[model samples]
Target chain A: MTIDLFQKTGAFAENKDVARDIRVRDIIPALERHEEVILDFAGVGAATQSFVHALISDLFRQYGNGVLDRVAFRSCSEAVKQIIRIVVDYMQEGMGIDTEDAPEA
Target chain B: MKIHLPNSAFLGNLDSFLRGFDSTHPDHLEITANDQWIAVHPVVLSMIAALGLTVKPGNVRCGPLQARSGHYVVRMGLLKILNIPSSITMVEHEPAGRFIPLTQIRTSSELTSFITEMIPLLHVESEQAKTIGYIVSELVRNVIEHADAEHGAFLCAQYYKKSHSIRIGIADTGVGIKATINKSHEAATDLEAIRLALWPGVTGMTRRDGGTAQNAGAGLFFIKSIASVNRDFFVIYSGSGFYKLLKPSPTRRLRLNADPFGDRHSKRDDLPFWHGTAAGVDITLDQTKEFAVLLEAIGTTYRTALRERKNARYRPPRFL
Candidate 1:
């Protein structure tokens, strides 16, 4: 399942409500069906960490850390990729799961 | 309540102005201004607007404005939002590339709309717009989701041509930080509540290491990190607790601190009690570090903060 984030979030995706909507309506269903989900950020300008957290933090809680393997972030700008990484790494840290690739401060 | 607008009140000298606020009477507000000139931060206008909203319209009073810059507040829409009849009149012009006047946002969708319209109004570059949008989104959402404010969040911003910085202010009248953080954790004082709120992975919603999916308690941490990297002033006040992140000197090495107190900052737990929260951030456009780099720094601090918090809960084997 390919999710065109720009289509829903415009250039900058900061609305948590919209993020929650996408999560409940699409992402969770695809992951539950054992299908891969692509979050495409080709034209999206930026995304808040809160928005990204609202979108996928629950997946880590429900499906465990394995959800990282199922979700693919495609065509993300460096900024978007870093934000996604922040949310992912911190959630893992809070869960007490070790991550080898965490970046330096 | 009485609030005196001093000659100047930007975040740097905002302490005295905050100290001047009389939050005694809940039914009425008395506003006085410096006779010669009144130049203040956007947060001051937001704070006054937020306060005025709580009072009965007729009960609120503003003495004659002798300041030459009284029209500045008028242009910012302070009088209109509060429904106060103002004697001062000024020609209105295009707001583009200038300012976001006083706006009240109550719902999530309203905030989304405000962000959409605000970027263009400021006429900033794409990268700068991202930072402004992110700040507005996270801050307003925090108020919407947690503050439980009836009047919602009042927001405004001004772009300073001389400094090349965007000054943004947001204020809300709701259950203050102490009440909110106390829901899940034991915050002994409002200052303790502000401290706990700044720490990553700590939320009033739940004490779980990783917050509930909807919230990770990392919003304020990210904001403070952005300002810290840029070496700009960031101020937040709720109840009698106030925290200000002082701009680091240029000669010092740039670093991100998971604990807000670890960063050079000024804190006050004795200020007049504000029923809700008022926050202001100055983003120097030229000094904006690459968004990617800022996030990487934030990632490190946040992850480290969470790990330390998690490890604190671990128990070692006891002696026989």
Candidate 2:
């Protein structure tokens, strides 16, 4: 399943509450259905760390290392990609996993 | 007691003035603006108005007077917003073109709308405006997520065309830095809490505390890094600790140091305890720094930090 962030929210998505709502209302259900969730960021212009964190961090804690294979990001700009990388690596380090060896989603 | 508005009511002067007010005093204080060169930012005015809202009616008096230019118009707008009576004679003049009026951010949607409206006021290119929006969004989000402010966050921006700079300020009356971070790290002092808050992956929220899962505590670290790389000035005041990133020299390359809170680079001021946090940023709008470059630089630095922390024999958990 593809989730168009810009369509769901807007070009700029930076609110934790919105991110949490997306997680509860959209992402989690897709994951439960054994479906691959692609976070499409084609039209999104920018995103803050807070927003990115709110969307993905809890998912990692719930699914553990298995989430690495279930989720992927598409059409991310350089800035958005960098933010995602920071969030992923930071979460992985917190979980005592080596980011160097972790699979890219 | 009469309080005079400064010619340049930026963060420093405004903070000092606001801190000077004695809440314990029973008498209402009078605010006077008689200078011929009275100039103030909406952020300052908004803060004063917010402070006034906390006090009883008529406890704060704003007596206005003569000004050389449109200063009185700005003052009048401030009074109108605050609902304070202005005794100064009414003046008919156009408002300043460079100022973005005070805005309140109570939710993420308001933040997004506020940033969209502020881009034009910044007088920058589309891409640069987006970058500024992202930075401002992060600063304001800190208040929303952690401030616990009863009245929400306040934001205002000013463009200085000649100086090629834009100044933005966000203030909140909520739990200060020390109180927030000390929830997880009980031993942290006020300055230490500020330093920890700036460090990569040092988040105050945890799963047990009902914090969002995606919060990796990277907001302030990324902000400070971007400010350093772009040669902008970033100042954060929470509780009694004040942190600032002094502008680097033109020839100096961007480097993330071991002590991100070093006295030489980021001065930590120990002021009287403030009830909440106020952050201000001054960025050169004309600078050709790209957001992509800043993201890459900050990403590299953060990854390096993460690798080191991961390799440590006994690394503490990141969220705590």
* DockQ in order: 0.84, 0.58
Model 2 regions lying over 4 Å from their true place: A100-105, B1-4, B9-34, B39-43, B69-77, B87-97, B120-123, B207-214, B263-269, B309-320
lDDT of 1 by residue, A17-55 (tens): 889999999999998899999999999878999899999
**What C-alpha lDDT does candidate 1 achieve relative to the native structure?**
0.90
Output the lDDT of residue B265, model 1: 96
Model 1 is docked with a DockQ of: 0.84
How well is each residue in B1-320 modelled by candidate 2, as lDDT tens digits? 33456666654355565455443443455666646766664455545544454446667777655567435435435566556655555545433446666666778677777776666666677667766788788888888778887777877777777877777777777888888787676635677788888877667874222134756677888878877777877777777677777777778666874246642355545565556777777777767377777787787788777666556646677995
Q: Chain B TM per candidate, please?
A: 0.99, 0.82
Candidate 2 CAPRI classification by DockQ: medium
Q: In candidate 2 chain A, what residue range of length 10 has the lowest lDDT sum? A: A96-105
Q: Report how far off residue A103 is in candidate 1 (Å).
A: 10
